[model samples]
Target: MTGIDPAVRHLTRTAAQMRKKKPMRIMLLAHSYWPEHSPPQRRWTTLIREFRKAGWDIDVVTPVAHFPQGRRRLPRSEAGTPFRGQRGPFGERIKRVPYLRHSGNRHAARLVDQVFSAAMSIPTALMWRKADVVIATAPSLPILVAGYLVARLRGVPLVVEMRDAWPDLARDARLVKGQVKSVVERVVEAIQRRADLVVTVTDGFAQTLRARGVKNVVTVTNGLDLEAVQLLEAPPAERDKLEVLYLGNHGESQRLDVIVKASALVGGDLMHLHMVGHGTRRPDLLKLAGALNAPVTFHPPLYGADLIARYRSADTCVVSLRDDWKSFETTIPSKTYEVLAIGRHMTAIVRGEAARIVTEAGGGDVVAWKPEAVAELWAELARDRGRLTAGLSGRDWVKANADFRQLAVQYMGHLSDLVVAGRSRP
Candidate 1:
């Protein structure tokens, strides 16, 4: 018999070992889940699919589909409504709980709804009697409390995944202040202390958590799900006019107003700016674009293949940040990875860690937030489009470093170790 390929052999052994061991029952607590096109939902959906394939029993407890935009009723099956129990892909189960749908633009109103939803999720999570481990993801930090209580009650490990630094981001955005900021910080820290594993999406976030005395922190940066994004053949470097695109959340941190101001400052027939995706700031941005008479088009959000096509059509992908916000320095937008995966050049109006990544990766130019600076860069790129077309190398870099399959494998190993450790504890 010929020897098997090393990779195949390793996979075979791993599969057999997984089958031999008791199947891990994992409960995921998030305020959002699949069918909501938000980043947290998409990230966890991909992770849950991989976990199910790896022979784990996955149960997701989330609020009904309502985010960025308000809730829409989805079709239900004869078996039951999705709110009761929905069978997700690969036999993974999802349980949607009740929550008030608040408008995204009002921060205080949104927080109230999230806190109420988080409280409702605790009882729903307790219903999953088979769960051996629990993971709580936070853009909504209240869910971490639910996960902590569930884990404590069931004698299982609680894994807290920080997609953003929560109250820090809120404070930086001026959504929280003074005593409110201190109280929020205390609550977030207390939740962090309860977790057996603290997973952060950025190294900067992990460092911040460590400084705040959180233990067992690990950085698992957001990456491209290579399987989902079908990279198309690169269009010619030469085009009739430049098309600059900014896709993904248009929230407070994005500072998309800078992009609009830049478009107005650089008013010419040579280039047009496109902003896609729905968020609290979309209406304000639309109004700004109109007031400035900028050559900017706003498109409603697209998903799956339609979103990929939009990326493929772009001459350059623009990423923006509010320069005044210190917390934003730590956020490496997931869109960065997506743009690189689609082999598109990036122009980032950012600083600190995000700028460092764009610069070091050779993905594209990192410009200051000033309209004059951005206009100048756009003019240069319009003249020599090759500067914006040199993204094949960036694509290669992403494939090598940020493939989701590899990250999923590493994540599973981490979770398995946590399970073993939890089992041994008194």
Candidate 2:
């Protein structure tokens, strides 16, 4: 017994051998990555950080960071190199591809950029070490095509992440003009069916995809790294007026005009809405605010302490999705979980899954999307400040349902199951 027990020695050897086994390798294709803090960046960055923590290797195939229009993040020297891999902060191997510069014609230009970048992604991904799986996330549809082709050529299982209600959204928005059945819808659906696993950000969308006969699907809702997100103290209720915040994009999908008109109705003397971030609609919103004389302050997008400062100064955060689009019912703004995690009351202008989340959290009221209804809610909140105390319900909701730590584990299990299943198939 004094001489090292044989069974204990055997167990130790087995443990060492397991540690020496190869870690899972994942090749991720997306429109954005680290150093660019957008919706996709936030979700994937947090998830990828957790994946790296688990000792998995992630290879990112993306184009030069030229998002948010009017701002190209990386310089020419740093960005446009094809087949040249750089290590990210999270240890991800970032392989950069060139992007197409656009004129004022944004929609058509951006599509061209996506197409160009997606084509480049193939060569970039193929040059990297072989991966066990290929994951392609989409709000940018062209990337899905690239992901499919790469996975096929490389002989790997493909995971297609539908971050938004794509084909439905395209039809709803009429992204393709003058056609009942557009090429865009057909391509998206074809890729969806062909993918090994279709992952949706909302359970509602996952259900929709399943109903459409997509074979394999899963739900991995957008979440934050709880430990990284600072929970600020709720604002004091003794103020003479209310301070409302809308910190995300100023896009058509948000229908921010309603929020502006609501603030106008609330009157500058009683309350003010702080609209932050930039988008195609910011200029129009500025003009609308000027015309209406709304008590709205527009700020360019802020990050780090600046962002947290704005959150601390707010009574409620606005999470909006246009109600007219049927597909939007299944969409949840990426900012929803962040607001909940940070314990802010929400003016949730949404329906369906997103509405259910806000109500369930007790952190906010799901108001009707109309300016009159939103204005009424604000007027009521201004009168009854006690309702502004969001309590810990929202934060609690995030911990249970939207924490990336838990969600990442779920993701790992999903990936493991898919990889194993792929290997097991004839």
Candidate 3:
């Protein structure tokens, strides 16, 4: 106490007091969980770790390990057996639900799998130990339904996390369309209205929801475990050809076709593009690249040290979304934050909020969504190698905005306030 800073001492005392209280319990509903390399899993894994340090209890209801490939690959112990609750490597408890076996890339099959698992999740969550709040994270939409039902029956505040700009994205993609308003849109908005809180990953989406009169929306954007992500070493000075890397989904929203075409337009001898991940559009992108003889390599996903090594190998990283879609105006790719944190130059093929963040960070330049434009930018970047080493501006932005430690604390406040207010209601 004598040598410690007063703030540190105060915090230590507060932490001790917090430990003495009954831990606030949370039941989270999701289509993915730990050991699965999905976006929701990554976001929640870091948050749950922080929650545990603060002495909170979390119970996760999820389907078995089946993502990208759409069938279980891990042993039951790691994936968790259906109807059995297993302790997570982090401090939370995970209750598994059965999933439908399907091909990873089949749309109808994936939808069926999501529906089956979501239905099973409702019962799994309802039978769990009591919780103060129930959180439903969407990437799998039916999980939102299960979350709402479970919260209502259990009589707790429901927090629906719309990770993407949903209903809007659905409309943009035309997943559902009617003469007036589709049933999908109605169902999503209804759930948003009924939920005690709506958590959006981007402030733009939060504002959008509020404009539509859903009053309880809050933005908790995707973030990094900064303490764990190192500032990557710069690319080699004597490189033969500049390498631009895109690591994440190879899906339509990315319009990766443009990227492949741009790489071909540059000619394989000048530069190379490495796209690492699985998605519905990956095979098509491969075919296009082959047809054009593009200098693009599509690799399966890399994680942990391998992912960092991939980042280290790149002179520039790409954070792209199709510019034609209005819903994307609010979408920020999770990897954008990662690229910024790791201190890489970017080719941000995005607009609105995502482009603004990149521009503000001074990490890189945003190019037009054209093959010739992208190819021209790459040529310019290649000619001026110095442009590829944007300094700590991006990292600084992440520290100020997207660090998970800070985000988790902000989220805890929201959960605590809701839990208190919820109990006080009639």
Best by TM-score: 3
All candidates' lDDT scores? 0.80, 0.87, 0.88
Candidate 1: lDDT of 169? Answer: 85
Report the candidate with higher lDDT, 2 versus 3: 3
So what's the TM-score on candidate 3? Answer: 0.95
Off by over 4 Å in 1: 1-21, 77-83
Lowest lDDT sum, 10 consecutive residues, model 2, at: 11-20
Candidate 1, residue 272: the lDDT equals 91
Provide the RMSD of all predictions against the true structure, rounded to 1 decimal.
Answer: 2.7, 5.5, 2.4
Question: How many steric overlaps does candidate 2 have?
Answer: 0
lDDT of 3 by residue, 1-426 (tens): 699856446546655655565679999998998899989888999999988988999999999888879988988789889999799978699999999998888777998999999999988888778899999998678889999999999988999999999889988876655754477788889999999999999999999999999999889889998879999876766677879999998887898999899999998777999999999998899899999999998889999889988999999998889988899999999999999999999999999899999999897999999999999999888878878887788888888889887788778878887888877888
- Candidate 1 shows a clash count of 0
| Candidate 1: residue pairs that collide | none
Per-candidate TM-scores read 0.93, 0.93, 0.95
Cα shift from native, residue 157, model 3 (Å): 0.8
